[model samples]
Each structure stands twice: as C-alpha cells, then as structure tokens.
Target chain A: MRAGDEEISVSSTSGSRPTSKDAVINLDHGDPTMYESFWKRMGHRGDITIAGWQGISYFSDVTNLCWFLEPEFDHEIRRLHRLVGNAVADGHFVVVGTGSTQLFQAALYALSPPDTPHPLSVVSAAPYYSSYPAVTDYLRSGLYRWAGDASAFKGNIYIELVCSPNNPDGSIREAVLKSENGTIIHDLAYYWPQYTPITHAEDHDIMLFTVSKTTGHAGSRLGWALVKDKEVAKRMIKFVELNSIGVSKDSQFRAAKILKAISDGYELPNPKNKYKLFDFGHLLMSVRWKRLREAVKVSGIFSLPEFQSSYCTFTGKRTETYPAFAWLKCEKEGVEDCENFLRSHKILSRNGKHFGAARKFVRISMLERDETFELFIERLSSLT
Target chain B: MRAGDEEISVSSTSGSRPTSKDAVINLDHGDPTMYESFWKRMGHRGDITIAGWQGISYFSDVTNLCWFLEPEFDHEIRRLHRLVGNAVADGHFVVVGTGSTQLFQAALYALSPPDTPHPLSVVSAAPYYSSYPAVTDYLRSGLYRWAGDASAFKGNIYIELVCSPNNPDGSIREAVLKSENGTIIHDLAYYWPQYTPITHAEDHDIMLFTVSKTTGHAGSRLGWALVKDKEVAKRMIKFVELNSIGVSKDSQFRAAKILKAISDGYELPNPKNKYKLFDFGHLLMSVRWKRLREAVKVSGIFSLPEFQSSYCTFTGKRTETYPAFAWLKCEKEGVEDCENFLRSHKILSRNGKHFGAARKFVRISMLERDETFELFIERLSSLT
Candidate 1:
C-alpha cells in the first residue's frame, strides 16, 4: 500500500485520481481508530457475541423511563462514571440514544415547550460542532430555532449548548451567555482524560456522552445523556421512542461489554498492566499529538493552537491537550480556503467555515489509524 | 409461575398489582417473541460475534449516501427482497436507518419541501400505527403535520403513509385516496408471509422494511428503505445523517448475519428443513392464531375480524390471516372500553382509541412468548 501511493499519478484538477493506489486521505470525520491496537490487545475479552433470541423483547425494563437501555448497559455506565469521576450519575437519569446526535436533538425537544408562543432560541459559541445548526434547523421545528453565537444572543428563553473540549478547536468551553431563563446542555463527548485534563466532575443539569469518541466505537452508534430533571429525561426518552423506538439493544449490549472491559482494565492493580484503556489511549494520543506538532513545526506553513497545561484529577498530574482533532490554520499565501488547499494535496478535511469559523482554518482528525496519520504527516511535510 | 398467577388476587380498579408473585402480561408492544424457538433451533448459525477491531472505521463505503451502512447489510437486504419477491430493489437506492420509525420520519422530511408556504399534511388510514401522530407532532416540525384518515384527507400536496397488513388489525390495505401530488410510502414491516400473504411485488416509490418485525429482532433496531428516486433517496440519507449520522454499523452487521442465516435456511433444498425462518415463523404463528381464535370463540363476548384467505407466493398455498396483533372487539354489556375491560382481568392491551379506532376494540399482541400467550389464552377463556 505504501509503494502504491508513489506509483500512482496525482491529478491536480481532481486532487487525487480514483485509483486503487493513491486514494485520498480522509480526515473529515473524527473516527477514533487510535485505540485499535488497545482493543485488539484485549482480544476475545472485548468481543461481543449476541444470541438470536437475545433482546427479542422491545422493552428493556418497564420501570425505567429509558426502557430501551439494557440493565448491563445501565450498570456499566454507572461503573464508568465512578471510575472516571467525571459525571454525577447517582441522581441523574440516563437516557440512551442512537448517538450523541440524537441526544442533542432530544435535548432540544425536551428543553423547549411546545406551547411557547415563539420557538425557543438554541445558541452556542462560535466555531461550534458543525452538526448543531444542521440538526436543530433541518426539521424546521416550531418548538426551537438555531440562533448562532450565544455571545451576541439576547433571548429571554433559550437553550445553550456547551461542547466541552470543543470539536474543531478542542478548547474546554462553558456557556458564554448567562441568563436565568436559559437551560444548558453540556456536550462532554471529548471530556475524557485522554483528550484533555479533567479538572473536576461535571455536575451539569444535562450532560451528553458518546462511545464514539470515548472508546473509538463510533460505528456502534451508542450515546447517553445524564439528566437531572425526571421530566426532561422522560421527554428525551419520548423523543427517542418516537424517533427510533429506542437505541439498538445489540449495540447497547456490545457497548456494555466493551465498557466493562475498559473499567476492569482501569482498575487493574499493577501500574504497568498494559490493558488499561485510559492509560493506553492517553499515551497513544499524547504521542500522536506530539508527532503532529513536530511535523507541523517542520512544515512552517501551518500553525496550531497552543493549549495550556492543566492539572488532571484522573491522572493526578499536569497534562497538555491531546484532542481528537487538529485545528490547522494555513499561513501560506493564496491559502484562504484551507480545506481546498489540503484537498489539493490529496487530503480531505472539514472546512472551518462549516463550524462558523474563518475559511483560513480546517479541522483534521487525529483519531485516524497510525498508518493514515503517518501518510498525512508525510503529505503535510511536503507543503513546507 | 402458573401457581403464582393463580394465588395472586387481581385488583379491579388499578388492574394488576405490582407484586413479585403476579406479573402483568404485556400484550401492548408487538415484540415478535414467536420466533424465539425457531431461532433457538438454528443455534450458533443465528448467533453474531463481532470482533474488537471489526467495523472500527465510521465510514462503511464512500460512494453510498449512508456511509455507515455495512456492505453485507446491503447484500442481505437485496437477498431478502428477492427471496420474498415483495419490493423492487434493482433500480432503487437503499437507505439504511435506525428503524422504520426513523425511515418514516425521513420519508416525511424528504417528501416535504422546506420552503413551502405551509407544512405538508401527512395522513394515514384509520387504525394506523399508534405512534404516527405522536412521532410526527412531538417535535412540532413546521415541515409536516399529521392529518388523520387518508380517506377523508383533502390536500393538494401531501405524503401518504400506507402500512400494508395494517398494524392493530390483520387486513391487507391499499391507499384509499389517490392523487398525483400525493407521494406514497409503503411500510411493509408486517408484510412477511408469516403475518400476511404476499400477493405480488409492491413497486411503490418508497417502501420500508424492518428487521424487528421480519426477523423478530426488535431490539436490534435496524430498518431499510427502497427508494425509486435518486434525489429523494439522497434527501432521506441526509435526514438519517443529520438524525443519527447514520444507523449503527454493529447492529447492521448483526442484522446482515442473521438475515443471511434466514435466506440460507429458506434456500435449503429440502422442504422439511425446520430451520427455514419463514416456514418456522408461519407454523408457529398459524398454530398460535388458531389457538387464539379457538379461545376467543369460547369467549363469546369478544369478536375478531374475519379475514379472507389469500394465495401466498412463498408458501405456494392459500393462507388465513396470522397477524402480529389481534384486533379484538369486546361485545359484552357494560364493556365500553375493551382495553380497560382486559386490564381489569390482568391482561394489558393497547386501546383502539390510540390507533384512531373506537374504544370498543383493543389490540392484543400475538407475538408474545409461548408461556405468556398460553396464559393470555387461559385468562381470556375464563372471561367467557
């Protein structure tokens, strides 16, 4: 595969020829494959075998508002919370979803009252996750409307979305607009110790998390929200029930088994247990970020944000940002559209404009496999 | 368990008491547990074991609009359609979803133009799936509104939903109101040979199918749509992309494996192959429906819809109606609400009012486990 790249001819017009050899390096989606080796090391322990008759019934448990959640999933989620010490799961009700995307929509549906004379404004800080506006406004719901940039918003009743360890830039964020009439939904998808320093447990009224960024199980399409209010949780559950009936139990069961393995690995007594998911993830991400920074330094055509070191409660030490994405700003001449510039070099990246940011910047996924990252670095270094 | 049921005293006002000894029989949800014994017969052939590194990448295929769909899923769907000879798949673009629920919403979203002067009215016949209105109006989306009873609906432009082998009842249905402006979405969720006879291949613009009702894997939460138009298919794909970023690949993979098993069982040379999913499902459902009819006959207070026999292509014989749900009408004096009457007797059912039908009728599920169905029959017979 490495030699095939050199043999294939590159087309300047189309960026890259659709040959078997020089396929375009896709860094557009944040698919976490850095934990591949870690998961592979666990072997059958991390594997999931679902029987034909398993989860034959649609209802998981009638008593719980999130009746779609498997009991093992509920247990694993609580265990992971206790181990990470990131979220307060005791009082909060957990609502499962297809992914954090569904939960994000569900949160909007739950937060906004249907009888509101005007649709409740949903706002987030600039350079937000690209899907926020798209998901919120696509349906054109009368209950809520996307009001971009919370900093400039002056709504009486609004829903504030806070994506901590923000998607594009990877900066730890909070609600910019403070108001008594506002309800906040914290998207803690990238709040794990591997991505950034965990300052303290987030006890927000509503918090969102996904197995996609956490355990690199994006294909599983599993996510959950921790909601403080029972009514809100019930509403979210109703939204899911009406949306997809419920989250897939097969995925939930798989997630539970994988999460259990991760929790067990984290609790291993030996410091050098090697099976510890967090330690493995942290080390891999730290190394990848270091290599990426070094490569970018050599290129001198691009610049990355300088993230400050912070104390992490989980690691009991200071650590720098190890984000899943590299927010790259092209400093070269005639590179106004950084995404197009990267595309010309056989690389695909998400445009910063999509995230309500400047066209000079682009978001590249650092969660790809090591081989893809290496090729990306090689292609990027040539731009110097 | 039988002895415990006999020992517990039933409450008239609140229905069944929440005690460890007496558990309520949930006949409300159409969870297909009738295929449990059939699946058990297949043993490991029906089991799905996913490795840790399997489906690690978020993107399944780049060319497809729904990039998260596993290729095996596409293949299995085509195979199943060909085997059943129900829906056209050759020229149609297949869009995978979380379930038919998401697909239904997607169809609505895709059919309605966002810039239209008013929301497009979405309608279905009376006794439609109970979730239609709830799912449509829950978000209060201005793109579309739920207009009940397609027969009485008058609209210039609208999307009509047609659930063949209609839910809450066993009657084979067709669109009552025909208009060129009206786009039809055929939900073939219960059109399998086990539930109803497949008269001919349904060549609708948009046809929906789910693994939940077809294979009794309700918890997997996987569904697909056969869309004839490329633009509409793309729009539906966009809905799913914005909804959950695509369906779960883990569930899709499992669905593919199970679907392959079913197809393989069907294609076996020997007609006596007990592992054939359709045959097994048919036999189980036929016997169950017969027993249920006998029990209802004994209980003269209840009456069931008399369905005409139809020639089944799959079975190569005429078959009576063996529906996933038994739409029962209470004819006893003082029984105004059939669901309430059944609830008072310790049987939980879905009220016909929920399906936009009269309160005198209640929908009882025929998809429960053998033990539960037997208990339901015994209790129903005692009510006579």
Candidate 2:
C-alpha cells in the first residue's frame, strides 16, 4: 500500500506473494486471440454501421450519431438475429449483453425467487465453467452457498451453470447436464465453431454466446442469450438492468455487425485452405490447438488424454475441437510445482486447481502465433 | 422475437410499447467494449505484444487507428493513469474498470458481507442514484432493501451508494452522507469540474469514477474506484474477478493510453494555445450541459435547477449537488402524461419515481451534445 513503491500491492492481507496465476499462459480463459488469423481478421479499428430497426441507423448522426446509427445498425442486428436465431429457433427472445458473463449473473438473479432463504444453495457440476462458482459465490456470499452437486441439493431452487466444450478439461457432453432440473443455466461460452462444432440442442433450456470468441474481438464485449421461456428472459433483462444498467448500445451494434460477417461467410476462415482458413475463428482455433498440443508434448511436464476421451469435438471426428486453447492435464506428481516452474520462466498458464480438478493440471491458452508458440515450447521443454 | 426483426420485443409480457427506460439504457452498466480493440490497436493483429502490462498502451501498436487518433500513441496508458490518478489523489489506487457502472456493482458486492441477520441494508438520500435499489434488489432480492430514511431499520452493515452530484436529481451535500458506523460507497460519477468541483473529504470511504462521463467515450467502458479500506478493496477485486473476469486487459491498456491524453493536456480541444487551461472532459461536459439547459428553458416542459444543489455543494449560500441530471418534479398532471409527452417526440428521459422521489419528475441526462439537445428541445416544444 506504500505510495512510493514501484509495484502496487495486489493483496489485502500479507501473503507469500500474489500467485503467478496471472502470468500463466491463461489457456484457462476462453479468449480467442490465440489464433493469428482470427486476430488479424478482427483487429480493425473503425465505427461500423448497421441497419436500423425502424428505417435509418441510429449512428448515422455524423455529429452526435443518434439519428443515423439506428437504421444502419438495425440491418446488422436483423442479420444477426437471423444467423443466431437459425442456430437456435425463432420462437425465443434474444437479449444482448456485455458478455455471457453478464448473462450468467443475470440468470442467477432471475432464477432466485423472492425472499426465500439465507445462503440459497446453488449447485453445479464438479467440473464446470470455472467462473460459475466464483461469480455465484462472490455475489451470493451468505445469501447463497455453492452446493457442488445438483442431485444432492434438496434446496428450494437448484441452479446449474453448464459450459459446453468446457474450460480447463474441455469435456462437454449433453449428458453431463442431465441431472439439472428445477432451473438449469448453461454458459455456452466456447460453443462457437472455434472451440467445438456441436451446437446446443435447438430446443435446449438456455444458451449464451459472445462475438469476442466467435469473431476474435474480445474488446467488443457483446454477448446474447437464447431463452426458451419468456419469463426467464424477462427476469434476466431485469437483472441486467440492475447489474450494469444495460449492455452498451454501441457494443451491441458492433456484435450485430460481426454476426453479419459470420453469416456472410466473410468472418470465418475456410478450413479447405489452411492459411485462408486461419482467417476464420474456427479455423484459427484449430491451428492454435495443433500448436498447443505440440507445445504440451514438447513440455513433457503434462500428458493430455486422447482428444476423443477429452470430449473436445471441435469440427467433426479427427478435427481438433477448440483452437484457442488446449486444456492439458498434468499427470505429474506436483502441478503446483510445474506452475511455479513455468511462471519463473515468464510463461504464464492457468492452474487447474481452481476448476475443481486435480492440482496437477494446467490450462494453457494457445494465444501465441507459431513463432511465440515455438519459443514457448522451447522454454517449456527446458522445464522437463 | 421474429427471426429477421430489426427490433426484438424487449419485454416478454404483453405491455405498452418500449421506451428508453423500458428498454434499459444500460448507462448504468460498464465495460462497454469487451475486447474488440485487442487486434485493432496492435498492428500485427491477433496476439500482439502490448509493451507494458500485456497489450496495454495504444502506441505500443496503433497502425489500425482512426483519423482522430494522436500520433504519439505509445505513452497513452501511463498518461491516462496520471490523468485519472491526478483527478483524485496520488496515493489512491485507480484500477481502470470496464466502466464506472461495473465499479458500482463491485462496490456493492464488496460491501455485502457474509453472516448477516438480514441481507445488507443499503441507504441513500431520497431521490438518490436510481441504480441503488434496482442493483440491491436484483442481487440480494429480499435480503437487501432500500432504506429511504436512515432510521428505517438497524442492520450491522450499511452501504451508502452516494451518487454525488446525484443521478436523476443531481443533488449533493456534505451532510447527505453521514458515515456514522456505516460504509459510504461514494459514487463520484459526476464530481468533475463540469458537474461540480472535486469535493474531497478525507474521512475514509470508497469513491468511483468512469472515463465515460468525463470523456464521452462510453464505448470504451472503463472506470475505477479508490477505497480507503483495504478489506473493502480486496472484496471488490474478488467481485470483479468473478463477474466479468477482470475488465478486458485491452480496454485497460486503451484506458491507460487515454489517461495520458488527460494528463498531458493533449485531450483538450486546443491543448496548446486557446483552451490550454480547460480539461477536455470538463469542456465537453460543460458544452453538453449548456445546450441541455438552454433547451429546457426554451421548451419549458421542465426546469433544470442548478447542478450543484442537485448533488454537491451549491454556491451563493446554498450547498446542494446532484449529478449531471435535472430532477424536475413535474408540475403537470400525472407523471405518465409528462413521460408520454416527451416520448411522443422520440425524446428519452428517466422517470424519478424509480429513484424514490417524492414528486413525479423526470431525470434527463446532460450527456448529449448541444445540437442533439437543440433537436430534442425542438421536439419537446412541438409536443408542448
């Protein structure tokens, strides 16, 4: 807390040191910049316009941008609705958000009934979206307890957040969420083709997606949810209103624009041409996965199970699932030791202990291009 | 929720047509852009090396920038930090956020303690920030209640979300927040010179600010808070970690870069000669306010009292302060009638009834520029 100190103290209580968790490769988080082409394709800076719902775009107002942007933005929004709606069905409502993270929070708020009980028991799978427990626990504090297993929770309400092609161990099967009843919420953050090709069941409970992963523009922060039940969507919107007020109109507009690109086949890279394919998010994810697997093999500190067993079904059989990350489980005796070794070398990776997994595993985000990945592989090899 | 509908039905229930308030302005939310800038700011695109703090400063990479971008982009972050930090004190930790709106949520989450008899009771002046009740109700539901008066109930924890120059009503007084055995979460969202002078009372409380109001870059979605108490600060960090997975690193870096523009005085309309002493943010805010006030006078639909009396210390023997909003107690027949009058002309203003105001008034934001205000005034005049 000293003012003159060079490094700001990141901890409240005196601890050994802030963990090198932040420095780790961060494959733990599903940021899509790992693929070079996906990164290059999305890294353009300019205000994009969309068609308006009424007639003219709301942002077309050159000076203040209220009059023109709506009409232009609407065209993009309608296109996105068609694309995302086709992915699911048209009967449901699509509520855009800052990210699926906001939607996830909103789902919890919406599902929770009026003054029910102290510490409401919220249950999720043993291995779930790593943030679910954290976000739930953080908000619910004493108001809710993160009851691990859904079946055991004999509480008033059972809320489960399921992430497909899940984080850390990328094992997402529909059967995994079978036990979720009462109120089940799914965080389909990585369900995009970049991670896995198998989309949600058209009439599944509730699903969420973000343009950041699908388009490799994490900065846009636009995500939406397809909710089968109208009441649930309403409550979620209310929660959003309470949380941050609402998602940014500009970000929403941009997301709608990007969605148009994907539907037009202009955003995604073609898998037929490796280089050209890399320009597409799904294709880029594939390239990063290959590089990551190579790095993991070279590192020798961990062993990845067969892709099939991992249940990471990206583009079809034999086609790797989820390019932006390679969730490598460390079979070593001490994952904490491996984590330390990597951090000391400045190659940051997310520790697996947080995701309800054995400490001996690490989630490495494949964010580096070939050169950086090769350098990382070389450094990783030295660890063994 | 038609597949190709430009405007989706925002509400699930069959109700009146949606207005700005009904639809959710989300001005209350933050982290506006998720991470779309990651690729665009950096020249090479995907996974570019951010020189400091991992892809932070704009100059580290700015080839894909807009025409308005400055040439000296490299020192953007440090400059922003200086600008934001200087706005407050040198010792305070101004961690840039997705937006000040996110910080508000974080502040609430941080203050809500575990093991409470009832949910945490939040108290603010009547006609306080509109988000206070909505945010508390959304998360804690029955656990937390908005105490209009300080004597309503006795709770172990009391968080005062002080939105000075307040939101909706634009009211601020030193006595408004009496930190007697309670935590004061001061939302200094509009305490800049344009709204009011910096009211610094070192009694010990948490304060928040966002670049959105100050810089008119709501799309950037960046804000930060300064907390005197370390425990409170740590909890806020945890809340952020769980919620949005930490503000986008790219946004933070961009924010840091913009911070420099504020500090180096380069952000002003004329940094060198004419507008040397003017802070760009203050100038912009003032310009907008001037136009808004003029429009209000010309139309006479509502009156905008002096900004200081609404939220902060008022001048000339009256000490009142409110954020950049005019909380007008409608002299008209019904609140709904006034709302309809404004809405008929496509003008949007928040109703103060939601903020617990005594009278039927509307809270109009002065964030719009002069020209937009003029058009809105013309429309309002026509309606009248």
- The best candidate by DockQ is 1
Give candidate 2's error at residue A75 in angstroms. 6.5
lDDT of 2: 0.50
Query: Per-residue alpha-carbon lDDT of model 1 for B311-354, expressed as tens digits?
Result: 98878899877889999999999889998899787788888887
True contacts kept of each: 0.71, 0.13
Give the Å error, residue B24, model 1: 2.9
CA lDDT, candidate 1, residue B126: 90
Cα lDDT listed for each candidate: 0.83, 0.50
Poorest lDDT segment (10 consecutive residues) of candidate 1 chain A: A1-10
True lDDT of residue B106, candidate 2:
73
The lDDT leader among the candidates is: 1
Per-residue accuracy of model 1 over A1-384 as CA lDDT, tens digit each: 122111212122111123332567877778787778888888787899998877776777766767788889999999999888888899999999999999999999899986887889999898888778878888888899988888889766799999999988999898898789899999999999888988889999999999998898888888999999999998898788878988999899999999999898877675668778788888888888888888888899999988999998988999888888999999998779998898888788878877778889988988887777877877787775
TM, chain A, every candidate: 0.93, 0.74
